[model samples]
Target: MVQSVKPNPQGGITVTCDNKEEHFDKVIFTSPLNVLTKVADSSLFESSKPKTPVEYLGVICLVLITKSSLTPYYVLNIADKEIPFTGVIGMSSLVDLDQTGDEHLTYFPKYVSANDSYWKKSDEELKSLFLEGVSKLYPDFDTNDIVSAHLHKAFKVQPLQVLNYSEIIPDVQTKHKDFYVLNTSQFVNDTLNNNSVVNHVEKFVNEFKTESNLQ
Candidate 1:
């Protein structure tokens, strides 16, 4: 775990990890935008700290391995309020069956507020709740068909794109020299996905390269 970040007297930045401390000429923080505020020293950035109180949505996903396929579609967007999950991703629809040993893989992803009470639910409880929704979606779905199931939770996975979000989004370059911030939160215009993540990384790298050449 990163304990703290401070500016070195000589040059660069000093990062204190749980086991050791290290100094680098340039430091790029890629964690969730809100997380950086907790682990790093805001004062190090002088007056140009990232905006605070950014709203984010956490995700609780149920990964299911089943004897048969769930849906022919790759993605099913849930619109019913009764459905606890936001969407169902049929991984098997895209991935080759040989890779999964002919078993089906499905993902039930639910987005919730950071302070959502659902986060407190036990894995078994969440699994049951999600399975209930699945059963409703597919009347033929049987518990016996499920070979295995697992729960995965991640906090601050989605940044709420409020009006004029670009105006408030943090700059990659901070006030302090050689310190930068690049994260999924920067993905304001597009939906947060693997493609957007790759695009953001490429844009960040190109921008960093341009800035470095100027210096």
Candidate 2:
């Protein structure tokens, strides 16, 4: 069997896993545009192809385990740059547990960028920095009280919302024969849960049925 997909002509792909060389009829990629442009066969689209720019940020969240309770809030969004990382959250806010009566303090410092020097350090060092951040947030916090530490690292946490994002919305059903593409990120500008893509799906369904000469 053979599969064909179209977008930009400069399509290049590499299969990382060891799998049988079986073929298919069609493939739909639901990845970022930056990556898609590479795997897409640009020529299939003919005239012009709309492109969008996307930037991402990495975040490292530190979970500090303490012997005392912190705050009542679940999410703490830190907007201050001087604080090194983002806000902290009390784990108890989300999970329910026996009120051991003994206090439990849990918070995290989110480093916006992974390239920072802090990211270069060992896990224990990173944990220490996180505890340090907590002390800074609350001067009365004692670093010695921390009994455990945890770290969570996530890439693409925040995508820099680019301008003119509305101008690049693409139709899944293109003029090319048997060529269709759908990306949730493209429809995530002003609406949530890819509302734009949902609307496009509806339109595509109607058009596809009509194009197929189906009543």
Write out the backbone clash pairs for model 1. none
The list of candidate 2 runs beyond 4 A from truth reads: 1-52, 98-125, 168-215
Best by lDDT: 1
lDDT of each: 0.83, 0.58
For residue 197, model 1's alpha carbon misses the true position, in angstroms, by 2.6
Tens digit of per-residue lDDT, candidate 2, span 96-165: 6466335464657574543666657777777767666677888887767777778877665444446765
The pairs that clash in candidate 2 are: 8-41, 8-42, 9-41, 9-42, 9-43, 68-103, 68-104, 68-105, 69-104
lDDT (Cα, tens digit) per residue for candidate 1, span 1-215: 88887778898899999969999998898777656777777755532355665688889999999999889988888889989899999999989999999999999999899789898899889989998988988888888999999999988777888888777776644667778877777776798776778888888899999999999
TM-score, cand. 2 vs. native: 0.53
